[model samples]
Target chain A: MTITITAFSKSPDQGMGLARDTRVRWALEEAGLPYEVRLVSFRAMKQRAHLGMQPFGQIPTYQEGDLVLFETGAIILHIAEHHAGLLPNDAHARARAITWMFAAVNTVEPPILELVTARIFEGDKPWSKERLPLVHDRIRNRLRQLSTRLGDADWLDGSFSAGDLMMVHVLLRLRLSGLLDEFPNLAAYVARGEARPAYQRAFADQWAINKPAAKAR
Target chain B: MTITITAFSKSPDQGMGLARDTRVRWALEEAGLPYEVRLVSFRAMKQRAHLGMQPFGQIPTYQEGDLVLFETGAIILHIAEHHAGLLPNDAHARARAITWMFAAVNTVEPPILELVTARIFEGDKPWSKERLPLVHDRIRNRLRQLSTRLGDADWLDGSFSAGDLMMVHVLLRLRLSGLLDEFPNLAAYVARGEARPAYQRAFADQWAINKPAAKAR
Candidate 1:
């Protein structure tokens, strides 16, 4: 069965590999799966076909055989469940890993996203500049806890798993805000994730598509 | 092993059951499982003991035997995976259902939590009134897509699985904002979820803990 996923035809990240398709691609690489990407322009992403695949009109929708899955967490989990490399064999360890996955998106990402909205979407608003510090603080609170938990640890739990993959990506967004630097351990943690062979391959794949176009423009 | 979970000693919602614990409680109920609840004060939630179980220092950690799990999405997923009722029997369907769970928390709840932040945490800010419309519009964008996907359907996917349970609870938070009312179909969908015996039991339990305290205060 051919595995196909959708990504931005031209990513707004401009080859930074922050776009979520990199997450799915990273998971596939970690799982040692060969998959195809179907690029969708921003306009086409709003069209009926793309909306049918991803109701949220976002990239990184996955398909294999008859199964179509959206949501990066779910896609990563699906791959992790089917493949041996991304999850632990121990039942309790696997459950804890999944807990970290949820913590990454739900608890950690929300504040980081607010920072994005503050800086990008509403950066021009009258409040954007004023609100930036508050947004940063909110992110800092989460990072403080995360940094405490992750101190001296290679991963959130034992060994690198999908949990680390998700958290590292979520924290990578903080590079622009420079918040991840406040916690040196977390910065090192994300650096470790980026250094992973799988993540390097995924980053390269997204870069291939995004970089040339960025230069052309 | 006895199943134990934590909740707010006194929930911020005044017992409307908007807390994440209710989501887990609802999942447990749907699975026909009996569980014990331990109440954690907001101060204690930040303390070392609670933080040990939940790194983010938020409630609704699950403990069974030696395994401790936090994050409502992961806890509900843990229950749904171990139990028979909360998930579909078919593999593809189960994956799709889990996608909705991720969609609920990752995609849907982020915008809603922003609304909460705008109205509650930053309500006194100079820009709160001016900024609220943008936040509301962001939410409307998500709900519009969700409404389109959920058109004339009883659930996000087939049956009343954990996905619906999650989406329903996520949407339930919007009731305080009254945004759910704007989309009649979604409102009805949430009503259907609330009408479930399990959700009712979950709600009543939280209400019992919260309502009398509100009156006394």
Candidate 2:
């Protein structure tokens, strides 16, 4: 069956591969699967057709024949479930890996999203600058716990499963804030994920589509 | 195997049944599974022992024999995967149900979490009152999308899968904010979830534990 995934027609982060689609692409790459990218314009994303497929009007929606899925966590988990590269064979280990996926989105990413809101949406507000430290503190608390859990381990659990893919992607968002540097192991862990061949290909592919736009600006 | 899950020794909402454990209990009740609770003190939550099972030191962690799990989404998904009542048997439908589970947390809950942070952590700040509308609007956007999707349907997709369980629990957080009332259909949908026999049991079970503490306060 042919696989097609939606992505931003116009890159939000220039060509940095910070968009959610890049992680989905990385997962597909890790699974050694070839898929087509369906670029969706921001306007089109909110239109009826897209919303029918993804109620959230977000990018990185997966469509394999008649089956459709959204939510990067779910999409990644789907890929991992079908592919050998992303999850453990053992039942308990697989469950633990899935736990990390939930933790990455629900536990860790919320604070980072708050940080984003503080910087972008509330940036012009008088309290934005002053209140940012509070948001940072919250993000730091999660990073501290995650770093402590990770330690010097190569991955969160073992063998770089989807859990690591998700946690690494979640932590990657913090690089712009520079809080990741505070935790050396976490930073290194992110670096290791970036160094993966699949991630490299995913980055390069998105970069190819976004480079001209970045240069033009 | 006797399933044991962790909960807060002291109820944060004073027996309002807002604790994460209530949702876990709801899942267990729906699955017709009896489980024991291991209450963890706030101070103990941070200690290495508790942190070992739950890296982020959060509540409603699941332990069944040697299998230990954290992240309520993960725990609930695990229960659903193993039990008959929580998930659809068809593969694609099952994936769709899981999609709602992720959407409930990753999409809908993030803004609610921000609202919590704004109210609790930043409430004393001068901007708190003024800034709440922005947070509320973010939540409203999500609710609008979700309400549109839910329409007149009693559940998100069909037949009260784990997706509905999670979405119901997530939306339940907004009842105090009164935003849920704004979307009449969504409010009714949440009420339907609470009206479930299993949900009633879960709420009662958590209430049983927290009632004494509430009276003491």
Against the true structure, whose DockQ is highest?
1
Q: Model 2 over residues A1-217: C-alpha lDDT tens digits?
A: 9999999998878888888999899999999999999999999999999999999888989999999999999999888888889999999999999999999999999999998888889999988888989999999999999999999999998888999998898888888889999999999999999999999999999999877543454
DockQ score, prediction 2: 0.92
Interface RMSD of each: 0.5, 0.6
lDDT (tens digit, per residue) of candidate 1 on A1-217? 9999999999998999999999999999999999999999999999999999999999989999888999999999999999988999999999999999999999999999998888778988878888889889989999999999998988899999999999999999989778999999999999999999999999999999999543454
lDDT of model 2 at position B157: 80
Sorted into a CAPRI-style docking class, model 1 comes out as high
Span of ten consecutive residues with least summed lDDT in model 1 chain B: B208-217
TM-scores for the candidates: 0.98, 0.98
Residue pairs clashing in model 1 are none
- The C-alpha stretches of model 2 lying farther than 4 A from their native spots are A212-217, B212-217
Candidate maximizing lDDT: 1
